[model samples]
Each structure stands twice: as C-alpha cells, then as structure tokens.
Target: IQHALSGLGYAAVKGVRQGKFFVLNLDGWGREEAQKQLERISKEVLTNPVIEEYRFEIVD
Candidate 1:
C-alpha cells in the first residue's frame, strides 16, 4: 500500500490502508445504539479480532 502511494509521488506518506466502506441500513436504531451495535459487529464479525484494527463513522 505504501509502495503504491509512494510510486504515485506521495513521498511523505508512511502508511496506506485500504478499508471497507459499508452502508448498513439501520432503519429503527438511533445514532447511539447504531454506533454501539456497529462497534460490536466490527469486533466480532467484521475483522480479525486478534490482529486487525478498524474504525467507524456515523454518516447521515
């Protein structure tokens, strides 16, 4: 990832990560509850719990 970015003339970039963007339609859940569930799902289902890291944003 870093190599590709560097080759594209982004010399200062030390790291590059390709992340997943998913639109999960939570029709009834509020923002707080949705965030909680997304966190849970992120840990338990979305990634490798032992090695990988992840982040989420609540988009309207």
Candidate 2:
C-alpha cells in the first residue's frame, strides 16, 4: 500500500504500529478525480479481492 501511494507521487509515512495512512498533496485535481484515482489505485495495487472488499462514498 505504501509503495502504491508512492508510485502515485504521495509522500507516505509508514506507521510504527501497524496500518499506514498516506498524506498526499494532490495538486489541483478536483474531488471526483481524486476519488476515481484512489479507487483505481486501491483495486489495481493495494487490495486483494480474495480477502477484502471496498466500498466508498464522496462526502462532498
């Protein structure tokens, strides 16, 4: 997951505990584009279908 985010240009800081959250400075892209890219990245790189399923909503 960290590698995937880095590949997308996010400067990710890995947590010492367990899970990681990426802090991204997404230039001037709108929320829709960000959400779309996140989904694509998660599916293609970060997640495994055999063990996980993802669902998301745009809050704004």
Candidate 3:
C-alpha cells in the first residue's frame, strides 16, 4: 500500500506505530476528483482481496 501511494507521488511519512499516512499534494484538483482518484488507486493498487479489506469515510 505504501509503495503504491509513493509511486503515485504521495509521501508516506508515517506508517508504523500510527497506521499509515500518505501526504498528497493534489495541486488544484477539486476534492471530489481527488477522492475519486484515490478510491480508484486504493481499489486497484493498494488492496489485495486475498488478504485485505477496507472501508472509508469522508468527513467534511
């Protein structure tokens, strides 16, 4: 997951004791677009159905 995010230009500054954080600089893209892109990336790259599952929420 960390590797996938890093490849997409997000910096995984913290990933051990506190789970993970991918710091992304989405230049000027709107929140909705960014969220959609991240969702695709997570589904296609970050997750392996044989081993992992995830759920998320957007708080705004």
Per-model tally of clashing residue pairs:
0, 0, 0
Best lDDT goes to which candidate? 1
User: Runs in model 2 with CA error above 4 Å?
Assistant: 1-25, 55-60
For candidate 3, what's the RMSD? 12.3
| Top-scoring candidate (TM-score) | 1
- For model 1, the run of ten residues with the poorest summed lDDT: 16-25
The TM-score values for the models, in the order shown, are 0.65, 0.44, 0.43
Model 1 Cα lDDT, one tens digit per residue, 1-60: 799889999999997777766667777899999999999998998888788888888888
Cα error, candidate 3, residue 20 (Å):
4.8
Q: What's the C-alpha lDDT at position 55 in model 3?
A: 50
All-Cα superposition RMSD per candidate: 2.6, 12.6, 12.3
After superposition, candidate 3 runs with Cα above 4 Å error: 1-21, 55-60
Q: What is the lDDT of residue 56 in candidate 1?
A: 84
TM-score of 1: 0.65
User: Least lDDT summed over 10 consecutive residues: which range in candidate 2?
Assistant: 15-24
Return the clash pairs for model 2, or none: none
